[model samples]
Target: MKELAYLNKFFFKYKWQLLPGVLFVIISNFFAVLPAQIIRIAFDLVNENIALYRLFNGFDKQSLILDIFGSSLLLFGGLVIVIALIRGLFLFFMRQTIILTSRHIEFDLKNEIYNQYQKLSLAFYRRNNTGDLMNRVTEDVSRVRMYVGPAIMYTINTSVLFVLIIIAMLSVNVKLALYCLAPLPLLAITIYYVNSIINHKSEKIQRRLSTLSSFVQETFSGIRVVKSYVRENNIRDGFAKESEAYKSESLDLVKVQAFFFPTMLLMVGLSTIITIYIGGLQVMNGKISSGNIAEFIVYVNQLTFPVTSLGWVTSLVQRAAASQKRINQFLKTKPEIINPNPNPLKVNGAISFQNVSFTYPDTGIKALKNVSFEIKEGELLAIIGRTGSGKSTIANLVMRMYDVDEGEIKIDHTNIKYLNLEDYRSQTGFVPQEVFLFSDTIARNIAFGQDQLDMQKVEKAAKDAAVYKNIIAFDKKFETFIGERGITLSGGQKQRVSIARAIIKSPQILIFDDCLSAVDTKTEEEILNSLGNVMKGKTSILIAHRVSTIKNADKIIVLDNGEIVEHGTHHLLMNKKGVYFELYEKQLLEEQQELS
Candidate 1:
């Protein structure tokens, strides 16, 4: 499979472990074939065969009995005992290596997927669900490990076992060996049909499983909204429907497995019967001795187990194939932004968009069309717009989140595409609209963006964001661990912490994507004031929905339908009798009326 080829390097990495595992299997099979020949020799010796009696004289009946019932059997049983012990020992190590190999692959796959996620543009997340992506990272990767590890081992072992049995059987009686193998072709055909059904059903099961995982994640995340809106029953019913689909699909896979294994056993039984009947006739007709017929029967069953193992191995393969397709898709995704020329741009807080046009990847419609803006050093510009008017797109472009389809964007007069993405991003700080905090101490979260520690700077940033008092109120102070998604804090508190994170970066340019939306207007004003002093001599882009928030900007740009409709100083825009004036007037009236 083209998709499976991606795992070639990983398989080669652990060949040391696999090599010993292969050797142990060979050794086990070698001893396994010896016993059948030994039994034939014993049969010959009992019938007054002088050669076998002379050959086995040292370990006679007394010695064999003592070895079995006393101590002499140990020598006679040496091959069997050593084979079992070596097989068991190697099996234990093999299991350990398998687990380690699976975990190692899992770790690499997760890291690769995560790093790709980081490199991808924001449009990628816009097109994919948060929950669905989580499923790919966790559930899909585990499935690949299961397939590559145990399934691979069993497939190899089974093939080897079958080959060794056939060789042993032919050495005793070629005609009977051929008869024993007659049922195998038919069995192969049946397994082919059964595996096809399993493959089809397994893909369906995996799809339903992803949907089920997504539904549970989405419902739990929105549990508050569901409860407040009295939609618990609706969500519960939806989850139940998804869960039932997953159950039904998994049952379909099991249905194929249920039939496949039993059919395999039936085929094995038929082969054994054929070998015994045909070999029985040869012995009676004096074509072969009874001892040879007995040896043939034992080898026939040895061959049967590998055949049965095919069914189990097939099931694991199908599950893996489905998972591999998803991972391959992730690996093949192309980032929206790439370095056509790898050069580092030295940033000085000035940015320009020259007749830029951009569109979201999954949608044909433009999010920012014919947009041009210039931000000079030490200037604060506010962006105000209605809900879908490309306010966030402008901020994304400044950070090179998505490259413009037409025209160019530059930082400090250098084209952003030529710059190394890591170096370019290092010069900028963006505080997103939705605040996301990790489950760590406040101090650590604030300093998360930087590589080195600076506790004093972190304390100063927290104070500047106006959350120092709140942090100190906790008994643990800056060391307090916020629970998942900052569940321990209020909405406004989370926003402040995120602002503190941006402040700690002290980047050349800062873009706050409506980061002040949650706090009260008074707190908003205080934080903005603090930002102005801290961000002096640096470029800042403030995005907000409130008129009071951006009235003091050196310039304010009004956006509508992915186009810039107005641009001027706040006061100048208010006197233009355009869209900006209407918004300001409407907001003023609403505020004045609220006072009444």
Candidate 2:
């Protein structure tokens, strides 16, 4: 419940509905308890009149007694029916106000959690799996809703009804009232201990479900990899193992819940038994009338349901508390990456890295050591490096996907950290080595950079990336529906489509990080030729392992171990005969042998 207190704001938000709902519960219980009092008066009326009818002992006296009985039955029975109808009407309003408000709260809570997910940095995602994230927003929120809706409603209904019944019972016979309610204290003590067990088991069950969900999500996402390796049986076995663990935990929770209703029923039974024995003795001793005994029995019966439902309501609150704790923890996470500048210093794309160094946060690998470079406006800078030589790291840094661990990066000599992150990213075009596209029409994917689709711009970008021919070859052309990650297209086609997506942005800063690796040398040349026109007034950085891809660059930097080993134009680097020369010679020989 302490964790659930985080939702106090929502109660305040919808207080109007809840206040009226509480009033309805009170009104409904008033109508409900009034009928028992009416039954008591009718019983006493008939019992007192029986002696009068017997005293006269005549046919006319019998007729008068019959009339009296008939009138009492009609009046009291009709009142009982009318009261029930009124109670039912208020109950309907209760659900409409309270239950509907709970749904509204659910909607607000889910959106808050989703917004928090979007606000968190990539580092948060790296720490938590997609399954746990999904569960907090979906399953956990549902559990909390149970507390907001049914649990709160029943608790209110029970408390009001119980108080009314107790007041009525004491007005009849104080001694009898105290005796009948003696078992309730013991019932309360028992529930106090049982709730702790339920809470513990519920937490374990939720944790296990998160694990099971993660395993399933990962398995389905990589089904292709499993099939390719012919490991379907192994995957099945792994799923079975995880499923069994989930089942065992769920059963443990169910076992605890299984004891609740019966225990509640046993307590109800004890109260009923006490009411009969004590109430009957009071009537015989002339301490209360027979009608009073009947009224006490009816009051005990009225209490049966509200008392029994306590078991269910308690469990809901406990489970909701556990769930809200998880959701609160998720919401409380502070992102490592936040915008330092709300109003950005406008960028003109002249970028500089003065004595920059960086390390990968997740892997703890030092990716760069005192590395530096400069790219002025309208200049093309190419970086050629082997795999794992921090090639992509530079592209990431330029996009500000991460900040440097040490040293300074600047745009037009202004600190890069001072730029508004959203504005900076919006002005940059980036295509990573691994291409990704949504499951959507090719036209929409190409125009994803803009809020509205522009077919003319889409076609132009496709031509610039040299993917227009492949797109039109399909039966649906630009309207083609690609599968997830654009799986319907070939590797080279996916890369080219990704490039089209970037080109359509028309950004001031463009980064192509080994994106041309999948396409053939001829297509690569075609794209580079078109890009030469597009890059006329923009700062561009190209990361590649192939010397031929970057040979015509205005300048090239060669990296071997997270540091620049050589840098110059293609000819100068070749003349130097260093790492760049060795790589170029090896690739050139491989090409000649293939041609021969």
Candidate 3:
């Protein structure tokens, strides 16, 4: 019961559909029991009339006998048909309302999980794998629906039939009814033990399945790397290992069911044997009529089905419980990054970091320490750093991907924590170092952030990003479909497309985190030249490894060991002959070697 408490919200939400469905189930079960009663009455009528005919032999009793049997048979046949028709009608409506409602709830739960995924911080995504999350949204949600649908339906059906049949059986003979139900307590004990094992096994099986799914997802996502390294056999072996583990856990669950079903059937079979032997003896001793004995046999047989169905329903309940627990835990996780203020001040692109210190989660070392900087509106600032100098960390902090451990980051003279995260982010456009594009057309990808595509704006942005000529060279122009992650396009084209996407947003501040690393110097210069007009009167931050990419910026900052070691123009940094100058000389020597 505690395991199922998570479903209370869904049950309440769909109560309108579920309440009527439950009523129909009750009505259907009631009609279902009427046939057994009809049979009993018909048998009794035949027995009594036969005795009367035997007593009144050779008289005008032939007509009476014919009338009695004829009326009894007609009433029994008509009632059977009517009851069957009513039961079938109600069963249809019950399934339509309850089972279909579960499906609707399943749909809603999937969307809700996806919505939660969107709201969660980047750290949450880092902690979980894609395939495990996919399994939770798909397989786990499906198991929950089984509980809401067939499990609930059969439980209700079994309860109603059990009560009505027990009452009818008692009315015939209390002693026989007691005897018929003697094995039920044993059956309940068996189910209790079996259910616990099943629940434990089910949890293990679901976890193994998620592991298998994650392995498959990762293998496919990095297939190119695997193939380039000629590790197909290794990957195949890894997959086989995961698949075997999954298979082993599944077989354990199957073993539990194998033990459970036969035990339940044995109990039901024993009860049926007891009822027949005892009721037959009563018939011979004249304690009960033959008709009563026959009806008792029918009632016991009817009870057998629901009792046997209990084993299956219990398994479904256990599986659903295990799945719901996983989903509940995921939903309980709150995002670490959230807007503190409902109404926040507008951003004007003026940014400042005051003695900020930060460390990554699950790591002892600080990524940035006591970093302080300010960029006035409409100024272009360039950040140059060696690998692991915390350049990307700075970009992440500016995007509010993680909060600072000390001091404050301010935008428009207000702490970023007090700003509406969405509104503040909307005012800035970011092109990450590794760009990702959807499997969509050029125009659609360019206008991805907009509610609707404006072709004019899209073309202008593409031209500004210097990718419009390459796009028009294609036969379909903007309508050309790029493959997954823009696989159909070159690296430079993908980078330009990403820039076009950001440009169309018309953000007040633009941040490029080594977005042009893939392109040649000539192409890089072309893009930068095209962006000159766009960057006018807008705050811009360019983070790059190449000095050529940021040499002409208003001011350049060089980072070493997570601290700014040089702050000046490119010419001034070169004259200082420090870390920045060393990096510039190294790059120049590499280019000269390539030409040679």
Candidate 4:
């Protein structure tokens, strides 16, 4: 019950659907108890030599006996059949309404979980694995639905039937009713121990299953690497270990259930034995009639069956509680990044970083320290540095993937924090060093951000990125489907496709984060030449390692060890004989050696 507290809002939202379903459950249980009463009446008729027709009308004994073989027996059989049919009808409605409501609730919950995932920050995803999250949305959600459906239905049915059957037994004989209920306290005590063990084991089983799922997902996603390294046997051994742990936990849960269910049945059987032994003696002593003893036995069986099945119902409830707790913990996490400004000024891509310092969460090392730079509107600024020199960090900051720890980033002389995040991001196009493409047609990938595809713009952007010739070389042309993560495309082709995607947006600012590293020198030159006209009067930031790539920029900044070491154009940096000069000299020697 404590585990189910999180579902209170869902219950309120779907009350209309659940209310009628509950009423049907009560009605169904009432009819289900009727057959026992009807059987008792038949037993009384036989014991007293009384005809059923005599009860309806005051007829003589002889005529009543004569009619027993005629219409009286038929009336008794027909009454039983009618009651059985009505009970079946109520049972159908009860299950249909409740099960459907549970399905609707499941649908709503899955969507809500997905929406939460979208709102969560990238740092949250970095901390969790894909398989664990997938299991929560699929398997855990199904478990929760069981509580709203079968658990709720059976709980109501058992409770209502228990009260009704107890009252019915009391009417037949009060002493027997008290005797039959005596074992209930012991049964409840046993169930408490069983439920506690089950709840603990069920939570363990779910977590172990999640661990197994994560292992499988990660293994398959990195299958190429595993095969390349000849680590198939090692991976198989790891998977087997996870699988064995899952199996052991599942069997433990099964063992608990095996002991629990039969214990409940034993309690029920004990109660039935007591009823028969005591009720028979009472009948022989002439305190109660034989028919009354039979009625008491039938009511006792009805009560005991539900009690015996309570173990199974409690298992479902414990599982749902465990699953709901996991889900609630995920939903309760708040994303660090959010839209702070209700109304924000528009951006024109004039970026300024003033005394900015940043450190990634969970890593004490600073990524950037006191980094300061500015790019005026329509200026072409190029950043060059060795690996881990905060080149990409600058791009990440400009894109607002993370906020600065100190100082502020401004666009168009207004703080970026005071600008609408979505609107500001819309005006900029980013092409990361590692390009990612969806499994879709080439044209769709190029026009990824647009609501509607403009084939003309798509083709023009492809042409500008210098990939149009290769695209038409395919049999399907732009309509060809690429494999997952663009597996079918070469590195250069994927990079060009990413460039096309950015170019088609016609953004006020364009960022090329070493995106041309994979292409040949000739292709790189062609792309730069094609992009010259597109970049005119637009703020462009190029982060590159090759000196040839950024030598022509209006301004070049060289970074080393999280700090800017040099700032100047290509010729000025060469004459200054600094870090940029050394890099240029090394690259020039490599090219000259290649020519020789």
Candidate 5:
């Protein structure tokens, strides 16, 4: 209930709907309870007329009594039907208002969670799995909705019925009514203890469901890997194991319910039995009429559903408390990176790293150390490094993917952190080593960076990235579906398409980190030639391992084990015969050997 308190704002938000729904519950219940009193009156009337008919022996007098008696019974029967119809109508209204409002709340809650997920930093995503996050937004919210709709409705109905039935019973005969209600206090105490056990079991079941969902998501996403490795049997066996665990947890909860519902029914049956025994004894003693006993029985039976649902509502609220706690915890998380400035600023893209150092937070690996360099606007600076030499770390810092742990990164002579994160990222074009494109058409994928798709810009960007020829060769050309993650295309084609998508924005700062690793040297030269023209007025940072790729740059920096080993023009580095010269000579020899 403490966790469920968070939903009070939503209840208040839709108060008008909830208020009417509650009214409908009360009114319908009032009509339903009235029928029991009618039944009592009809029974008493019949009982009275039985003696009156016995007293009138002659035809005329007895016939008169019979006619009146028959007519009165019919009238009472008609009245009960009308009351039932009226109650049914109100029940319809109850569902219309309350159930519909729950759906609306569901929509708002899902959107709220999705928006929060979008606003969270990448570090937050690193900490949580996609399945757990998805389950919280979807399955957990669904459980909570059961509390908001059916649980709440049943609770209100039960409470109203209890009040009406108890008052009516006491007014008729206090002693019998008290005896009938003797079992309820024990029933309630049982529910209280059962509720704690159910709460604990429900949370365990939900966590198991999250684990199951994660396994399925990961399996589907990596199905190709599984098939290629011939691990289909292994995956199937794993799924079976998870499914069995999920089934076991579900059965454990079900077992508790199996124990719980019967107990409630047994208590209900006991109350009914007590009503019959006590009421019969009172009637034998001439304290109350048989009709009173009939009415008491109706009230007890009417209580049957409400009493059963009391347990159900308690169960629902408990599960909902568990789920809402998870949701509230997620909502409370503040993103590590936030937009520092409300106002958008100009981006000339003069990016500089001053005494910069960074460590990957997840792995705690030092990827950069006190490295300093500056790339002016409209200058092309290339970084060459061995694998794990922090070349990509510089690219990541320039793009603001991760804030540096030490020292300052500035753009246009302002600290990068001070810029609006949205504005800064919007002005930059990044092509990471691994390419990811949506399961969309070629032109649409190229134009995915913006809201509006322009085919002309798409074509131009595709031509510049040198993927236009490959796209045209397809049957539908730009309209061809690239498949998931662009798996329909070859590796080099995917890389080029990713480049096209990046350049389609005409960004101020362009960072390409090993984006050309998939293509041959010949295709690389053509793409680089096109990029030279496209990047004429923009700041470009090219990160690569091939010397041929960066030899023509105005400046090149070589990184070795997270430190700068050389920084100079290509000519100066070659003349110095340092690490840069060694790599250049080695690659050149390999190419020459392959050519021969």
Candidate 6:
């Protein structure tokens, strides 16, 4: 019930449909109760010996023939017609209401989740699996839709039918009504207990279902890897375990439901027997009329349906409650990064770090320790380091992927954190080590976000990256669709395309994190030479492992153990005989040995 409260506004928004639907249900129940009355009336007429004779009275031979055909049994025939019409109308309205409400609610929920996904930070995705998030968006949301549709309306109808039946029963014979309702208090208590058990188990059941959904999604997405590695048997065994667990959990919930529903029916059966036995005695003793006993029995059966229906409705509500909790948890998670009074900064490409330090949230280990550097506009700065020397961390910080624990990063003398994230990020072009390309046309991928891209500019960038010839050789040229993750292209081609994408963006600052590592040295030099003219007056941070890659930079900063150890030009650093010089000499010797 608490979970459902969140949707009160949507319910109110569609209450017009609900109101008519409820009215139709009540009208249908009214007609349904008529059969009981017609039965009582016919029984009384028979007991008085007036049924057949009176129906045929006041008719001559000719009129008698007409009356026999036209004077049909009025009470029973009228009830049949009434019930059919009412049921038709009710079914029509209920179907329409359920369809409209479910679609509207589902649309609203998906939209809200999408909005929340946009607001969340990259850190959230780092810890969460894509398949798990997809499950919540699709499966869990469908469960909530079911609750809002048929479940809510049916519950209301059950409650109304119960009250109507009770009133009709007590009117004819209060004693029999009280006696038949004797087990109701106990039935309510039993339902409460069953509901509590079902709710607890339902939580586990939904969680297991989510896990099963995630397993299927993850396995399918990585099916190629599984096939390549010949791990089908291992994957099958793992999936079987998850599937079996989900099956067991689902069966357990079904077992509880199976047990509780029949027990409720048993209670209904017991009450029916009591109504027949106790009411029959009263009739035989001449304390009550036979027609009244018949009516009382009819109402007793009517009462049973609502009570039994209550159990199933309770189960659905419990399942919905569990789903709502999971969804709410996701909705409540505030993004790790947020702007506190943002001011958009227009960068002139001068970037500086003043005593910046950062630690990961989960590990609490410093990724960067008091790291500081400055690069003026148009400078080609190279960041060189061994793995885990904080080279990548510096790029991440510059992009504000993670906030600094202590100190400030400024662009054009303004703190980067204070700038609007979107604005700041737009001015920086980032190409990571693992180039990710969408499964789209090469032209679309290169001109990613810009609405109207200049194809000439795109061609120039591609030519500069040394990948234009490759693209032109393809069947559709720039229009060729790259298969998933650019699986259709070679590693070097993919890297060059990524470089082309960054170059087309024309950002004030470009950060290339080992983007050219996949290409050969000759191709790399060609691309670098082409970039030299375009990179004029633009700040560029090049992260690379090979000494030859960064040797041409205006300044090289060599890092070791998360701290800067050396900073100078290629010749100056070589003369210093430090870590950079040793690595450069070793790389040069390897090249010489290969040539020999």
- Index of the highest-lDDT prediction: 5
Global lDDT for candidate 2? Answer: 0.89
Residue 234 lDDT, candidate 1, scale 0-100: 89
| Pairs with steric clashes in candidate 1 | 66-72, 67-72, 67-73
61 Cα displacement, candidate 2 (Å)? 3.9
**lDDT value for candidate 1?**
0.82
Order of the predicted models by lDDT, top scorer first = 5, 3, 2, 4, 6, 1
Cα deviation of 118, candidate 6, in Å: 2.3
TM-score of 1: 0.92
> The CA-based lDDT of model 3 is what?
0.89
Q: Estimate each model's TM-score.
A: 0.92, 0.95, 0.96, 0.93, 0.97, 0.91
Mark the 10 consecutive residues where model 6 has the least summed lDDT: 64-73
Better of 1 and 3 by lDDT: 3
Q: After superposing candidate 2, which stretches have Cα over 4 Å from the reference? A: 49-57, 593-596
Relative to the true structure, candidate 3 has a C-alpha RMSD (angstroms) of: 1.7
Best by TM-score: 5
Q: Can you write out model 3's per-residue Cα lDDT over 1-596, one digit (the tens) per residue?
A: 57678778888999999999999998998998888888878888888888887888888977788787898799898999999999999999999999998898889888888888888887788789999999999999999899989999999989998998998888888898899899999989889999999999999989998999999999887877899999999999999999999999999989989888888788778877888889888888898877776787778788878988898899899999999888877888898898787774567799899999888874556888889989999999999998888888889899999889999999888888888888888878899888999999999999998989899999999999999999999999999999888888999999999999987888998999999998999999999999998999889999999999999998899988788888988889999999889999999999999999
Misplaced by over 4 Å in model 4 are 50-73, 342-345, 594-596
Q: In model 5, how large is the Cα lDDT of residue 484?
A: 76
Question: Arrange candidates by TM-score, highest first: which order?
Answer: 5, 3, 2, 4, 1, 6
Worst 10 residues of 1 by lDDT: 65-74
How well does candidate 4 match the true structure in TM-score terms?
Answer: 0.93
Evaluate all candidate structures by whole-model CA lDDT and list the values in order. 0.82, 0.89, 0.89, 0.87, 0.91, 0.83
Candidate 6, residues 143-171, lDDT tens digits: the string is 78878886787787787778778888888
How many residue pairs clash in each candidate at the backbone level?
3, 0, 0, 0, 0, 0
